[model samples]
Target: MTFPRVQPEPVYRNPEAVARAVGGKARGNRVTVHAPGHKKGSPEISILVDPSAPRGLLVNCFSGEDPVAMKDWVLAKCGEPEFTPGDRSERPEPRAHLKLVRRAEPPKPFNDQYLVARGYHRSATYDYTSTDGEVLFEVLRYEHPTDTKTFVQRQPDGHEGWLNGRGDAVPYRLHELAANTADPVFVVEGEKDADRLASLGYLATTVPNGSWPEDLSVLSGRTVYVLADNDATGDKKAVVAIDRLSGIATAYRIDLPGLPPKGDVSDWLDAGHSQDELEELCLSAVPIAANDNAPPGKPLSIFEWTVDRFVGEAPAVEYLVDGVIPLGIPGMVSAAGDTGKSFALLELHRRVAFGSGIYAPPIFGGRVVSEGVSVMITSEDDANEVHRRIAALDEKGDRFSSAGKRMIVVPLPSAGGARAFWKEDRRLGLIETDDFKRICDQLHSIEGLRLVTFDPLASFAHVALNEDPTAGQFVCSSLARLATETGATILTAHHMRKSKAPIETLADAREAIRGSTALVDGLRLAYAMWPADEARAKRTCKSLGIHYQPNRIVLGGVVKANGAARRIMSTYARNESGLLIDKTSGLGTSAPAQDDLRTALVIAIEAAANAGAPFTKTGASGLFEMRERLPEELRRIAKGRLDALAAEALERGEIVRSAAKGEKTAKWLDVPGGLFAIGLGNFTTGAPR
Candidate 1:
């Protein structure tokens, strides 16, 4: 049978002296004979093994053939070439062993004594235990000698692991947490912070792995406040914990500000934040679920809608302009650019606030319920410009100064300050936000507020006005609710499309309003203003003998009157004083003579006949053309008065009209003795026939 190679035991001469050698230093002629298959390069054995006298040590110790066989065995073990017995001085240095020594086992029930004995004099121990008071793990945090920390846990068979040998460890202070189920649990990243918070009288706990627990079901149905350490890892752990505990508990993250990197709750306490302040901080933490802040409600049955529930509630329809503009409903005024829409609305606001009647024909009987508070919220005009407009309107002698605090003019924010009223994350528009609510609340505090106006609605609306009908409706609905809740009439100014052609009738003006149709459909009332026919305005100015400004003529018409009259048109002219006045009642000066009206009608009819189309008495085209030929003063008179002028011209035979062939066709027209009698052939004479 082949024998297995065995390392011989090393012989030590003067063993006591060799054993007493420290760090390769020895005395008393000591020698060591290493066995075959034994490592010769070990530093521990090198002190006794001198290479110069290897034969004396081995041969002197082992006689006969054993020394030679041992030498060959040692050479084979060292992986050196075979050498004669006398060639020891030329032998190579042997290789050293590479195997590591076995580590010592740590003591059980590690305490302050074990820590002190291991050079961890200044250290803290935190024990993580089961509900039955059995210790599962302990974390030792060393502060002195060196800054280091370690985790240790005992196993079921009395063996120890760095952390827990079992699966995952439970949270620190599991027993205390079970004892106080009603109190809010404060979760932190580590056991030290947990213990620090617990000593401060807070119910604190942490995971044993020094990270967020994979499963946070232990905190189910409890309010949890996670104090994140001021570091990336701590934030990550807190976020994970929050996400895991979302539906299971009302979890909130508390991040202490002004902390150093890697700072923790202990550091916050060290910085002198008291328990009361910490509690306040915890209270201020935002809940992980945003909907948690919403008001609670129970489901209601559809059958709850009964007649008695609404029969006793008959809300009377109130109005700012009687039938035209109903109170408790949103209204809009749309006008083309440079039409003085803002000035017109401001004038209305003045009228409402000072209880002054409009100089023009009354749209809503030109009366208010009473002199009451009126608010004008405008984004187009600044405070100074608004004040200037108000001051200019006050020139009408209504004495708005006497109204005192009733008139509230608010200039909205401009670019940079302006934010979207409808954000993607919120269901409420900016008008319903807390900022606007405070505004409304303050205005509602004023007794008898009759009207609130938003000049240029597009400025306040942040959504795509033309694309999003729903957002438009939402804004209108919000305004309507504001009106209904506060009993104030709300009017918002809007813009109309610029028409290449002049707006002659109310229908044409209504069609010119800009934006989605919802703007008009959602409101109870809407009004439109556009530039009147330039020819008609100029003719009216000439008849009245007043200098005409083309832009000064504005035609105001009711577009949408849900609870009121269908068509109410008014002619407004801005005078040299910059105040819009009612020109439909005729100019401020005297009226033109009857003969001049007839002469003007004959001239227009003869001119129409000369062209392909003849003049018709009732046709709009014929009337518009005839009015264009008339003097400015006559054009200012209402349409009824102008029609009467045409009838008188026909009765006196100054002009004659034929029957119309169709609805749009104008009746044939002729002079008493044909066109020649009207001096068309003798144009140089410049005289009537």
Candidate 2:
């Protein structure tokens, strides 16, 4: 008969260690050896041993007068069983692992000591418990002949396994999931707080067992917020964390109202406080104000966020001209490159600044938008070109510097370096954002500022026109924001994208944007200029020539006129040496001489022959007769002696001769499709050609 090999007992080294670990020892009345055909032993279970027997399963002895053994002590009674060679092929000595269920007192302080003295079991690394006091779960580890201590046990399918080091042993996968960001970070003093906070909604973490780690390396590039507890220890630990988080993330602290003398975040959470209360506590906490926060006075309480509701300083009420324009908003003038938008803005700006008689209807209208709307222009256009245009307009060949208080042109710094390059490089237009922001700062420094003109956004920006949306988005957004911040109208100049929609609305301005769509949506006032004929495919708005009046503010003018709503107008005008002049096509400055009226009568008489009813001359007499028919309510003027004509019209230009000698003069006659600026699908007037 053969018996299974039994490994030596040191426990971890062999099956003998398991016996010792489970409080087992050799029997007192013991047989020297056993074979397959041994006597049926009088033990509860007999171990018929062979030379190939599994480690401690042997029916050798029956113990006498041993200590009232534990209900689940390691019993050495084993019965023999047939072992198939196939089953034992790989495993040199195969055996079944089993344990009996029985109640036992948990390990206590003196339990291990009493067990060692009895010699029933040997002592291991940790002392055993003699009496129980909770935490009574028992875990067992397996061992091998080579003294290798294993932390796993045999699987049911007869495979081996180990304790889950990845699960219970450590937490390596944190903040790796999308849900992590959705969870608010909780700060605790120790692991206990972490466990407690986990019970709540927060994903809390704690410092190491010892002192807090010098730097919370996890916060290096994360968007984590600190919520330190409200105690000296917690606060001290929080300070350490705060120092480590310098410039890493935004952080805050939690203050528990009437907190326990030694409570932590868990204590507060355990007290049944809602998350809202905790949020309130967090928000009320102030930032770590530096000791030297000697700000002059509280920031002038301006809640600029509510754009329309804002009412500026004492001079808030602005008076305007003719009630046609309530108060010009000192708006922005924009157009495609070389279309004359810049020259127009410069001309109107110059006129408004000096209060010249030739008002171009932009920043004019007599609204003192902060000291006659101070023109703070960051000369984004060519200074020499601007000078030439100004000279040509003035008839004096004078440049801007000579304009004095009327024109405040901020020249580009003459530094000869990359700075100079940026001044001219349209790709560097992002500098305009910085420029706008800096202007805000300057406004704060100099008491107040009015209208700011950031010309030709491309000169300072590097965004792809029309292709990228951020350029437009940024310009428009910043324009609104800067306007709100300084309470000054921001007129940023930008080029129109080549491809535009049917008709450009302020909203569609997002698409026509040169660089970023953000600029279009962000801007409240989007002034798009095209060839006038094709700003949009539909020619919906006015398509007058991209006009200019060089007598206005240098680069500080706007183009919107009176009675402006969200309306598109097709303006018709003549270019007077690059200055925009209203055109009265074939209109007379005043009532003509009787012979001149007679000439018109003769033309109307002759023209009536081909038409339905023209000899009456009502078309030519209409506007003139309406003046005579005005009642006191309808006529603003109280019927004083009228100078037959508005004098200025007669001075500069001559009127075209009509068909007859005594013909009455007619000004511009508004006709059909007048909403569009007199130019649409018909790009040209064939008669003129």
Deviating ranges (above 4 Å) for candidate 1 = 1-316, 357-365, 395-402, 413-419, 423-447, 542-545, 586-689
- Candidate 1 lands at a TM-score of 0.45
What's the lDDT for all of these models? 0.63, 0.39
Question: Estimated TM-score per prediction?
Answer: 0.45, 0.33
In model 2, state the lDDT of residue 79.
24
TM-score of candidate 2 on Cα atoms, chains taken together: 0.33
Q: Give Cα distance to truth, residue 203, candidate 2, Å.
A: 42
Candidate topping lDDT: 1
Clashes of each: 10, 76
Give the lowest summed-lDDT range of ten residues in model 1.
680-689
| lDDT of each residue in 1-689, candidate 2, tens digit only | 44565344421123333333433332221122222233333233223222333333333334332222311122322322333334443224434563335574332222232223333333122111112221112222333443433221111111332221111111112332123555446566655566565666656665432234443455444434455656666666775555455455455545577678767766776788877887777666544322122234566666756667746422322322221122324334555555566665565455445545433333321223233443545445455666676676666433334444545555343222111101223443433422333345555443334555656555545445455565556445545555565565566676765653432232343345455444454554455544433322122112323334322111111123222222222232325455533321222333333323322322222222222221111333332334343222212322222222212112312111122213344332211222111221111222110
Candidate 2, superposed: residue stretches over 4 Å from native = 1-331, 358-373, 376-380, 394-403, 411-436, 445-448, 463-471, 499-518, 532-576, 584-689
